[model samples]
Target: MPTEKQPVNFIESALETLLIEQNALKILSTQIDDRFSQACEIILQCKGRVVVTGMGKSGHIGRKIAATFASTGTPSFFMHPGEAGHGDLGMLVRGDVLIAISNSGKSDEIMMLMPLVKHLGVPLITMSADDSGPMPKNADVALTLGHLQEACPLGLAPTSSTTATLALGDALAIALLEARGFTADDFARSHPAGALGKRLLLHVEHIMHQAEELPKVFPDTPLNEVLYEITDKRLGMTTVVDHENTLLGIFTDGDLRRLLDKEQQFNVHTPVSAVMTKNPSTIKAGMRAVEALQSLRDKKINQFVVVDDENKVIGVISMHDLISAGV
Candidate 1:
């Protein structure tokens, strides 16, 4: 068999593509001017949702852009122009904003939607390489993202152009995000199922072990009894509570080690209160899990007593819990 020509170096090819994309992005960045601001203003003033549309690869990027906008305080959704021609255009309302993506600015599918979009009095924003094309001429605001050669040796594939378009979409979304004064908490609210949301929105109450699951003993309980509760609960610690079940203090594995180092016999009957740290660091059930984790780190503690507004012990949360949740 003829030896196969050495495989085209895939890694080298990929690096070259990335370098081309970077240069393309730089060119697009320098082109950002008053038109970009005008696009942001149009989207900001839109009373209805943003409807993004395109064909082929541009369609995929448009869908992602729509999602980013939706999750970042801008109400948006993707509309396939082909689907729109087939009755999906009914989804567009009078006040909605339309963002049409086409590298060449002459996609037949996008051009087909322009008249309807105009008739509805919706603002049309076109992202295209050609500023003079029909789509740009019809659009209320044209975002010209072009002037870069493709990375493909064939020069037919949309390699650098798509990258530039994606970056331009990001810049637009971020500008709108800042203009809306969107914060991490606001982003977390929109993405409650994601890791960042878990860190920012989840609270001690949502994860802490409560009621009978809490390892607790009266302050007067013997140290051995406190150890028994700790072992039975498997939290490596136990809370010392008052008669009304209010948190008085906490004892942990660290405290046990210190006691052992002090030569205290395991059988010695010391009061649990004597071995516990009074008013140990605690967190409220409603506090954000991320804030709780920060408190734990700042105080150098592994466990926190979850309490109610009245200072009654509700539950306990460990550093391991936050870590397990990827917070």
Candidate 2:
């Protein structure tokens, strides 16, 4: 601890810590050998969840690793080793796989639960600094983090070791994700309220204005009436359809501005079809909202006329609507 009497270089200290941890992660990458693949193989064949257990700082990292696995298609959860010694050992079932994290490979709390875990026939996977300790000796697959040089000035704290462990955990989780052929859509199903979920799961029809809420007009409708429809709907645009409700074109507020600039004598009584944009890009009602947003960005357009398979107008989807829907 630096006092007011001594000058401290905070930037230098932080940079040193980061560099040390980064090197530890680099070393950890090389340590990924046959044992890593064996662990993944065991997990891939598991019929039950992955139960993660650790103590102290390792516990915190274990929880995060378990969460990543859970969200990425693998079923996983964390169990406190200390708590497992009491009644929580029941959480470990026969088909489940156990991932024990202990930098020293000899956490007393974790070692105490090994007998019960083994009796349940759970395949043990251990992460530690090396494969020399009891935890790794008993594991079905021992993932060694290599020899890490701690960033702590006293070399008493777990710095580089924990960072390397986290990196190794992420590597393992992603390997399983790829092996399982997990997709973005699959990930979205597990996170329906997240941004990615909204983008993938929310469709055009879910957020589009339909029925009377859509601003639509016949091709022969007067320009002034089209502006009224646009304002009434507050969508900044209106679809121009024929008598059969088959979309012919679209008219927007921007068209009004350009019409004013081009025509010396503007006539609000003129047919909107004469000034409307012909064959505007349209989207199906079932299309994903994110696809609509991508189209908007690609074509430099703000909205789409939602149409059916027969090109009949069903609804209208706007950029504002997509944004509001959290797509």
Candidate 3:
């Protein structure tokens, strides 16, 4: 009689699963060739959205692939194959491209909708294990994942195949992203609620302290009066400008500390220009907040004078403001 099987080491089993899936991905990478490029070209030429569809575990991967494509500059949405048969097929239009994902290239629901897809004249792109199936045969471009052994110990789960499919989807999305010259600002536009959006979209002008909020004084202003301006404005620094508002220099709390530490004599009525830091680093109001933050860090300073075309001090911006504003 056959004996009952003994339990295997849990870590060894896990490692084995990962190794199998890794090997599958290695094989899948080598399979990418002209067919992948053709699929990308079809998508590039599509005037409408790239509609993705799949069934079972493939459906889950399809949803993520569609989302990645959408966020990365490709206009895309996931359409369930089962739902497509029930009038959702109307989502597919003449200018659209349909990408169907099926490990075997023979999902019944996706197969059932092919007639309507063809009638609508939408380009069909199929991803599967091989190019022999009906779905691949009918596709405008067929992308294949090399034959993969399942990572499952019993060789039954969708482990390695799903990993390969997801990787392929990411490859396609990133290729299109580069081909379209997509920028961080473009991605930020699609994700305004995230940290990157705040960095790229927020401008120095939007957050800078301006007008009465700016602590500024003329070259002849008394040192005691300049301190009051810095205190009242709460910006920790004051711009020393000429009568015409052209920036001459700046004085900060740090400057006050260093000056007092070195000098033995007291002079409250000293002209700020005598001690101010001339030609301090400045930024334009139109600069992105992220760049402003970087400037602050690079210069080892707390703030910047926001200048215009003629180096006139229009506003004051600080690292504190950027951090508080989520930049």
Candidate 4:
């Protein structure tokens, strides 16, 4: 028979763990000395990509650090130390920077790879608790993460040490990102498949309804004809333009609803210009889709006209298009 599990106080346990990690992070902050600056300098000076490597728990942290660097405009990748001793060592080049992570500073796999890394004339940066450890002594710049007791009751698991290492890695990555003048658009290019990239990289031109697909009406067009354009284009709105196709105003579902609610009798022969909102919200074709979305959200409106420098309607954008494009 399977053993019956007792109900554990999970929330309390989680809080305690968080408190311990917070304390550990506070301790780690005090040790940011000259070594940290040295590491940053080495990375900033590198012409080639950053190569991160470690063993076990440190390996996991190294992978995250490599990913953060890569996404933030720094070209970087993680190399397994054990595998590096095999043919993987070929990945390291002369101008590259190597970041080795080990809390104990005695990981044999890392030590074995250090000489080959040195022989390749690459700069090495090490993160370890012991400044005198073999890896740190061999490195050109040593960032000491310092000693913080594990949050684990037994003091055996990685715990606080890994957390400190990860934090230090994040600090390095972000600092370098700012130094390199990395922008949101640059980050989006690296992460093109995700929602963040869609928000940063997508523009009005990519999602707006253009040409004949846009719901538009001439100023002299009948009010009922404008209704037909709105229904046919299915954007819940239509733009009013003049003889030159210059945007004049917009008529939306809200406007129609209000008109109907007020019981206003409209002559079918009347022009739409009489009731449309003049100089409606407009966006440029090159504007980011995310910015357009925010504009619509702020105004509590669902549609905007994409206009040229002369204020001529080039296209139309809607909340539905932004949603469908994952912006």
Best by TM-score: 3
Which is superior by lDDT, 1 or 2?
2
Candidate 4: worst 10 consecutive residues by lDDT? Answer: 261-270
- For model 2 the local lDDT of residue 43 reads 96
Any runs in candidate 3 off by more than 4 Å, and if so which? 1-10
Candidate 2 residue-wise lDDT, 131-220, digit = tens: 999999999999999998999989988889888888888999999999999998898888898787888789999999999999899988
TM-score of each: 0.88, 0.93, 0.94, 0.93
Task: Put down candidate 4 lDDT per residue, 30-115, tens digits, no spaces.
Answer: 88888788888888888999999999999999999999999987899999999999899999999999999999888999898877
- In candidate 2 the C-alpha lDDT for residue 46 amounts to 97
Q: What is the model-wide C-alpha lDDT for candidate 4?
A: 0.89
Model 1 agreement with the true structure over 1-327: per-residue lDDT tens digits: 998888799999999998998999988988799999999999999999999999999999999999999999999999999999999999899999999999888999889887888799999999998698888999988998768989998999888998899889999999999999999889988988878778878888888988788998998888877878989999999988898988899999899999899875765578887778898888888888888888899988898998888899999999999888778
- Which stretches in model 2 have alpha-carbon errors above 4 Å? 1-6, 194-196
C-alpha RMSD (angstroms) for model 1: 3.0
The true-structure Cα RMSD of candidate 3 reads: 1.9
Number of the top lDDT candidate: 3
- Candidate 4 error regions (>4 Å): 1-12
Candidate 3 structure quality by residue, lDDT tens digits, 1-327? 999999889999899989999999999998899999999999999999999999999999999999999999999999999988898988888999999999998888999998988899999999999988999999999999999999986877899999999999999999999999999889989988878789878999999999889888999999999999989999899999998899999999999999989997659899998999999989999999999999899989999999999999999999999999998
Stretches of candidate 1 above 4 Å error? 1-7, 194-196, 243-246, 264-267, 294-300, 308-312, 323-326
